[model samples]
Target: MTDPTGVTITERHEQDGIVMEILEWSRLGGMTDPAGLPLLALMRTAELPVRQLRLTLTDAAVVLEAGALQAWHGRIEVENTIPAGRLLRRMVGSALSGERLFRPRYSGTGVVLTEPLLQCLLPVGLQDETVIVDQGLFLACSGGIEVGAAVQRTGSALLFGGEGLVQTRLSGTGFAVLQSPVPDSELIKVTLKKGETMAVDGPFAVLRSGSVRFSVGKSAKTWFGTAVSGEGLMQILEGPGDVWLSPLQPVYDGFAALARTLGPDATEAAESGRRR
Candidate 1:
C-alpha cells in the first residue's frame, strides 16, 4: 500500500495481534549535491532504504516514545497517563536510562505512522515475561506492557559492562518495537538452559530475558592471563533464558563516529569552493 505522500509499504510484520508495515521511499529529495544522486540511488538499491513504521490498530492502544508519532488517521485518542505523584520518579529514571521522559498512548481503531528512521525496527513479542533491553532501543509497545528501568546487578558491571547503569525493561504480555542497530537477519539469538552463561567483550547483547543475571567479569582468571589474551573485562550473562546479540555493532558504531567527525568539515570545504 502507498501513503498519501507517495511512500510505499516495502514489508509487513504481523504476529500476536500486532500488524506493522515498513514504508519506504524510492528516492530522497532535497539533496545538496546533484553529483551524490547516483551514490544515493546505489545505496537505495543496495537496501539502505529510508523507512517508516505504519501501525494499524483495531480497538487497541499502543504506547509510543515521545515525539515518535508523525501522522495518524481515524478514531484515535492520544493521552499521557503518567500519574502526577510518579512524575518526578519517572523523569529521574528517564534521565538516567536514556529513555524518553514521556510516553504517549494512542487508542482506538486507526492507523498510526512513525517518523522515518534509518535504523532497523525490530518487533519482539513477550509472553507474560520480562525483557531487559539496552538504553535508547525502545520505540513503541502494546499498552498492556509495562515499561520501566532496570539497573546493573553489581557496581563493577555498572562501571565496566559498557551498557550503562540503567536499561529499559519491558514486562507483561504484548509486542514491543525496538530500534535496532543491525537488521534482524544479523541478530543472533542464544537460548540458554538453567545455569548456563554467556560472555562478550562489548555491549553487543542488546536484549536478554529478565531471568538472566547480568554482570561483568574478567576475561581470564588473572591480570597476566588477561594481558596475554588481549581481552579485559567482559559483559557476562548467566541464564535460563534468551539473549540477543549484534556481533557487527562495533563496525557500525565506528563508521557512524567517523561520519560525525568528518561530514561537517567536508561539507563546509565543498561549499566554500563553490562560493569561490
Candidate 2:
C-alpha cells in the first residue's frame, strides 16, 4: 500500500524477522559497501523515504558503513551475525541500550531543521530543556518552538569539557557546543518553501515561516518585524560552517571581526542614505 507521501510499503522475509517497508532509493546516504549497508536499504527497496531510522539492536553483527556505532551509523559483521537476544543480553549486563542507530524521517510538520538551527539534549531522557539557539537560527519542531515576544524561557543540557549541565538561559550560560556546517564561510542560502515566510536579521536569518513578513530596521529591542500569513513553512539555512555555537573565544572573535569590518561602513552608509 502507499504511504502518506505516495510511497509504497510492503513486508518481506530476510535473515531474521522481517524487513518491512524498504525504500526506493537503492542506497543509504549514497553508501555502496555490501558489508555495511543499513537495513533501511530494505525499506528503500519498498520505496519509502525513511521518515525515521533507528537501530533495534547493536553489536548483533549488523554492519552499517564499518563503524562501531558508538555514535551514529555503526555495524558488526554480516558473516558473523549475533542473535538479537545475545545483543540485548550484553547491554542488559552493561546497563546500556544496545540500539545505536539513527533514523532520519520527514517531520510531520512538513519542516526540517539543520544542526545550526536545532538543539540537542543530553541526559535527554530526564531533561526537556532547550539548551541552545543562535540569535536568528531556524527550528523545525513538528510542534513549533517558542519564539518572538511569546518566548519567555527555555532550557538545555549543555556539553562542556566532556560533561553536561543545565543551562537556564542562552547568554552567560557558559559554552555550548554546536555542529559546524560543511563550508567554512562565505554566503549561505536559506530556502523558504511555499506558504512560508521569515523575519530576522538578514545576514544570519535562515528559513522563516511563510506567514511572517520581512522588514529592515534598527530597533535594538525589536530589531526585526513580522506578521502572520498562512500555515508557516520551514526555512533552509546555508552559510559559513563557523555559524555553529563554539566556545566563547572563537565566537567572540568572529563577532568582533564582523563588527570591526561593518561598524564604520554601516554608520557611514546609513548617514549617506539618509542625506540622499
Candidate 3:
C-alpha cells in the first residue's frame, strides 16, 4: 500500500516475515543527482526488511527509540516520552542499556514503517508482564510499556556477567518489538519452575524477564573452587517463568572475545580504541 505517494509498502515475502517498501524509481527526482543511477540499480535486487505497524487512534500509543522512525502515514503526534524530571536518570539508563538517550513517542492512528535493519525483528505481546532485554536489543515498544534499566544484583555481578552494568527492562501491558541478531529458530527457550535455578557460562541469555531473578554468583562453593574450575563469576538465573538464550550476539561477540583474549588492561585499551 502506497502512502499517498510513490512509496509502496507491501509484504512481498510474507512467508519469510519480510515486508518490502518500494519507492517507485520514476519518482526519483533529485535522487539521481549524485550516484543515483547505481543506487537505483542496486535498489532493484535489495531484499530489505521493512516493518509496517498499524496504529489505532484511541488505543495504545507507539513509542520508538530515537531514530527508529522511517516513515509514517496518518495523524500522529510526536513527543518525547522522557519526563522532564527524570532526564538525568534516563540518560544514565540509556548509557547502561547501550541505546540512545531519547526515545520518540508517537500517538494517534496511522501506519509506521521502520527502516530496514540487518537484525531480525521480534514482536512480543505482554499483558502485565516483564521482560529484560540485552543491551542494544530494543527497537520500539508500546507507549503503555515502561522503559528503564535492569541492574545486576551487585557490582561484581555486573562486570563479569552482563553486557554492561545495566540492560533494558520493559514492563506493563502492551506489545514490544526487539531487534535480535539471532533468528527466532536458534533462540532456545527454557522455562523454570518456582525455586529452580540455572547457570549460564557467558552472555548467552537473551531474555528472562518473566518472573525471573537474574544475578551473578560464584560458579562453585568456594573462591578457590571457582578459580580452579575456570568458571569464574557466572550468571545465575532463578525463575518461575521463561528464559531465552541465543548462541551468539554478533554485535558483541567479536569485541567480547577480544576482551577475553587480552587481559583486563588490554581490553580497556581495546574498548577505548573501539570508542575512538
Q: What is the TM-score of each candidate against the true structure?
A: 0.84, 0.17, 0.69
Which pairs of residues collide in model 3? Answer: none
What is residue 167's positional error in candidate 3, in angstroms? 0.9
If the candidates were sorted by their TM-score against the true structure, best first, what order would they fall in? 1, 3, 2
Candidate 1 lDDT over residue span 92-149, tens digit each: 8777767677789988888898998888888888899999999888888887898888
Candidate 2 structure, TM-score to reference: 0.17
Q: 206 in model 2: Cα distance from truth in Å?
A: 17
Off by over 4 Å in 1: 1-10, 13-18, 29-42, 260-276
In angstroms, give how far residue 148 of model 2 lies from its true place: 4.9
What is the TM-score (0 to 1) of candidate 3? Answer: 0.69
Q: Candidate 2 on 177-251: residue-level lDDT in tens?
A: 222221123324444554453333222332222232333322232323222433122222222111222223345
Model 1: residue 20 alpha-carbon error in angstroms: 2.1
lDDT of candidate 3 at residue 246, scale 0 to 100: 86
**In candidate 1, what residue range of length 10 has the lowest lDDT sum?**
266-275
When 1 and 3 are scored with TM-score, the better candidate is 1
